[model samples]
Target: MSSVSIHPTAIVASGARLGANVRIGPYCIVGENVVLDADVELISHVVVEGHTHVGAGTRIYPFASVGHQPQDLKYKGEASRLEIGERCVIREAATLNPGTAAGGMLTKVGNECLIMASAHVAHDTIIGNNVIMANYVGIAGHCRIGDNVTFGGTVVVHQRTRIGAHAFIGAQSMVDGDVIPYGMAVGNRASLAGLNLVGLKRRQFDREAIHRLRAAYRMIFSNEGTLRERTEDAAELFKDDDLVQDVVAFITSASDRPILVPRNGQVASED
Candidate 1:
């Protein structure tokens, strides 16, 4: 708390907690209920409010607004909270809002996340560890984004959408439904294009796992039979692979939107 420099224009509330090695720069506003852990740095003009708790070693750049009131229209000032995990880097102008009471009283962001400039995490969204949200990405209320996910710039997620772990969402994509695990997704009304090979390789997904996932994707989106005809057992050849099992569960579990299909009537992409 005492080691770093704090500018004159910053207003820190008495109830706010600042840990050792924390630096608050010019025009920064820290609200009463805000708690910042050790080694966290805040650049100029950052506003942190509304019962927000930032974990250790996280850095917030200039003009970032965190823990503001939820954007939900049903919100009536209920007691809600926002929690950010350790070692996260929130770039300039990124905005993260707290959760509404109806959507659970707390919104959580996991460790080692990088939220780029102009990105917005709206009310009640749960973002997992090691996730990357590129510039101008917008995630709406009640969305769940899983671990090791990468969102391209300007990708938009609709309310209540769920994107599974290790998925890659392409730039400017509008995602309205659920995206299954280990998939590469893209499009205006977003669809699953193929398996996320880059992500799988980066995460070192085993050959058996990648093979199984590919087979499962083929059955769901490209099989010559109807969805009812293509049962889970049809894709059971790769059932030994947990990642493929993840894909199977996602398709069978989709009671809302149908699992994405390709216009070419094939599962794998040309690329």
Candidate 2:
């Protein structure tokens, strides 16, 4: 391998594809089916196995277990894959599992993600770009995490849940349902607390846009009508607002889980 660096104590198995400038640190183990892109770094004691493809410039910290087989009892060693995007930082002891046949045979983490220590990404989960998961965050199988989402420490998401873009999951939350984009959720069995105003401000959304989104959110969640009716109204009202439309689209999209709402708001109905 030209320009690649493997520590003397590391074991890079035969048939592993190592791109230029890849670094396998001390005691790291890379499996035969693994493909490490250029400038990838597997820090000490990291185990990257199975059919995993780590993108360029990604850094996996010590003791991280990446591309492990699915935890599903139905998984019978299918050739599923774990694909991690570029420039991700996977911290110590984080566990990322590959997909299962039932979940499309792929688990994907998008570019520029920061997975903190002890976080777990289970089989078939799709994490979007620039996402951040704090320590002890456990995402169950088949969850869809949208771009720029942030998870506070110890957040636990149920299987098949979808968290929309820019949503914030507070510490110690147990998310069992779908969360809308730019929403803030907290508490055990999380409910929509409010908009992620801080995130919107930090992301530099204009005041008028934020104001419109806030108005749409209140209208959609108010007790005047069914969630579907409210969402339809919001869709028509915010026709020119992309941000509000995103929330409306997410609400209208087919989902197995209920859309989480504020505790005082009307319950999300299937009709």
Candidate 3:
């Protein structure tokens, strides 16, 4: 007898592969090409299909339309894939789409990220490890989100933007540009508010590293330096720390659509 406990109400196709100790709750559907690894749990009303692979120990909650078709207009019914990494918790009603031909060959969610309810990750967006996305966040096509980042509720990241590691984006924020490492960006068009201090504390960064990050933020934001001058100065100051180098690199790599700049005195609300 199979150790998988699939509820009678769930509909799993015969060709789908469920590994050891997997559980499928009521009304969930696993399609032919889906693969659920060991100890995975799918709660009610979930759908996994289309070359999708759910890694070990992951828990997918109710009504998540994961591994669905990419929302891009250019998709031509290709057999692209969706890969969710190990031990990740996908909360209620989150949607993860497959990659399109123009986007890439796959859309991946990295290990240990918590994608909250109603958040949508579009085609070919690659999410990194240990990130936390609050409710109703929407990441568009081809965005690259880095590790240990936290996004507040209803955050809208535009297409092709890159949000770096340990960044904090406030709620209802619109991210039109790339967010640098250790950044705290808020508001419409999401300007940098400061260094992500609370996030660094959660990661247990030492005082010295935090200070160095703050100094780099000062050069980038407070000094009113142009992108080129600030980057050159930051390179000289942060040659030792790779994290600081991430700040410089993100800024320099940005094209004509420069990443969001920091705003000095703008206040954010929780409405």
Candidate 4:
């Protein structure tokens, strides 16, 4: 007999894979191809369908929808997947969808994440470890969110945007571009306000590293040459500083969208 505790009212397909100590609560549905790792718990009324995999020790609350089809019109029944890493807490009413073929056929949520109630992670989104998406945060398709990033409540990110590691996006912000690592972005359209100093301090980053990152931030955003020039200069000057290097690298990296800059200044190329 299977050691998994599946409620009598739950609908688990015969082909579904359930690991030891997995629990499927009342009225939950696990599809044929779904895989629930060891110690995973579905509270109630959850639906895990398609080719989804829930990692070990993750707990999904009532009414959350995992591994559903993508919302893209281009998705014509491709065999995509949604993969959630270990120890994540998927709160009630959240929905995570699989990727489209153009986005490499996988949507991923990393370890130790807290996806708050009513949040939506769309097709092909890649979320890193220890990330927190507050209630009603909606991440559009193909966005790459780095580790330790936090999105405040009701924030909406545009498709294909890249949010770097340790970035803090304030509540109700509309992110339409790339946010560099350690950056703080706020406002309706979301301008880069400053570095995430409070977050760095709370994470116990070394004093020297934080100081160097601050210096690099100032130089990068100063009213001078183009952002490209500033990024090159910062890369050369702070080559030894790991945190500063991250910021420079993110700026120079090829991206379809423009990088987010302070709203008070123009960030386009300077002649």
Candidate 5:
């Protein structure tokens, strides 16, 4: 293990594992089962408790609470864990809780994620790589957030919702359903606004792929047939288009929450 720096005011339990160049700032508290990987920095007044494992190169700003017991009422002193991936930035006053026995016993935040100030990641939630949650975003328990998803400030997601990769939730939206990959949702009781065209362009998706995805999206959401039938038609029609296939597969998958629809359309549940 490389040299670790501990401020005199910090209280790191003896059983905690600190990797090389880890810095525990003043007034921080690290619990016995906490693991801080190499180059991890707890800026100040941070509390890392429970069986939390923070990956290398992560920075936690002041007043963040990590690896804490879940907010679930059923979580009765279970041995759950919170695993944060490398190079993530957890901003001030963010709360990340561990999973519960009912939901796999692990809460995972993937690499390169940016969780802004006052964001709350609830019990059993799984957040994928490169996700960005703006300030005051609250994700309820058992939610799944895919890679490159971005949430504007103060977005609140209901429990068990699944948001696919590259999706965007506009500020102050209340998300209660599944959001498809590369989709954009907005407004209270969030509805699918459109394709995340800007995100696709920023990610440099080819023009042809974007065009096909748009075409398939229109077909699948059209009023011609049931959603399941439309999804099946899209799957067959866009067999060669990976982007279209991804959306089609997401629609076909079984989920408790309905797939978000356009602002004026009926909710798209499995037909």
Candidate 6:
């Protein structure tokens, strides 16, 4: 007999693969193409459907929906997939959807993520490890969220946006563009505030490194020639700083959305 523990009221398709020590709680539904890796736990009333793969040690709270169809109008019932990495905690009512054909066919959430209640991660979204999506946050389709990113409650990220690692989005913000690594964005239509100094400090970044990053930030956001020119100059000046290098690289990369910067006449103060 299989070692998986499944409640009598749970509906698990025969074709679903449940690894040892997996637990399916009451009224939960596991679809035919689903795979729950070892130690995965679904609390009551969770629905994991479609071609979803839940990684080991992940715990999903009641009423969360995983691997559902894309909300995209262009999606046509294709066989796309959703992959959740290990040790994730998906809270109640969170919805994670699969990718659309036009988006390369997969939506992915990396390890150690905490997706708070009622958050919606739309089709084709790629979330990196250690991300935190606060309650009621909504990420539109095709967004790329990097590792260690933090989204405050009710923040809405537009489609195709790229949020770099260690970036912070303030509560109730509307993000429609690219946020550079270690940057802080705030406001309805988000604008770059400054470096996420508090975040970096909490993460144990060295003081000297933080100092250099602040200098680089000033150079990049200066009202100089063009953003490209400023970025190039910052890159050259901070070539020895790894964190600054990441910010410069993100700025220079080709993105579908424009880069987020401070609003006109608003200057970011040094940390």
Whose lDDT is greatest here? 2
lDDT of residue 234 for candidate 2: 94
Clashes of 4: 0
Q: Which portions of model 3 miss their true places by more than 4 Å?
A: 222-225, 254-257, 264-271
Best by TM-score: 6
For residues 133-245, write the lDDT of model 3, one tens digit per residue: 99999999899999998999999999888988889999999999888888888899778777788878877999797778777766766445566897788889889977788
Q: TM-scores for all candidates?
A: 0.93, 0.97, 0.93, 0.97, 0.97, 0.98
Looking at candidate 2, the ten consecutive residues that score lowest on lDDT are 262-271
Candidate 4 local lDDT, residue 221: 91
lDDT of 5: 0.93
The RMSD of every model to the true structure, in order and in angstroms, is: 1.9, 3.1, 2.9, 3.1, 3.0, 0.9
lDDT of 4 by residue, 1-271 (tens): 2778999999999999999999999999999999999999999999999999999999999999999899999999998999999999999999999999999999999999999999999999999999999999999999999999999999999999999999999999999989999998887899998888888999999989988888888789988998889888999999999999899889888997899998878432211
Please give the clash total of every predicted structure, in order.
1, 0, 0, 0, 0, 0
Residue pairs clashing, model 4: none
Using TM-score as the measure, name the better of candidate 3 and candidate 6. 6
Q: Lowest-scoring 10 consecutive residues by lDDT in candidate 5? A: 262-271
lDDT of 4: 0.93
lDDT tens digits by residue: candidate 6, 1-271: 2889999999999999988899999999999999999999999999999999999999999999999888888999999999999999999999999999999899999999999999999999999999999999999999999999999999999999999999999999999989999999999899999989899999999999999999888888888778899899988988989999999889999899999998883558746
Off by over 4 Å in 6: none
Better of 3 and 5 by TM-score: 5
Model 1 clashing residue pairs (backbone): 1-20
Q: Each candidate's lDDT (Cα)?
A: 0.85, 0.95, 0.87, 0.93, 0.93, 0.94
lDDT of 5 by residue, 1-271 (tens): 4499999999999999999999999999999999999999999999999999999999999999999899888999999999999999999999999999999999999999999999999999999999999999999999999999999999999999999999999999999999999999998999988898899999999999998988888888888878899999999998999998889888888887999988776433321
What is the TM-score (0 to 1) of candidate 1?
0.93
Estimate the lDDT of model 3.
Answer: 0.87
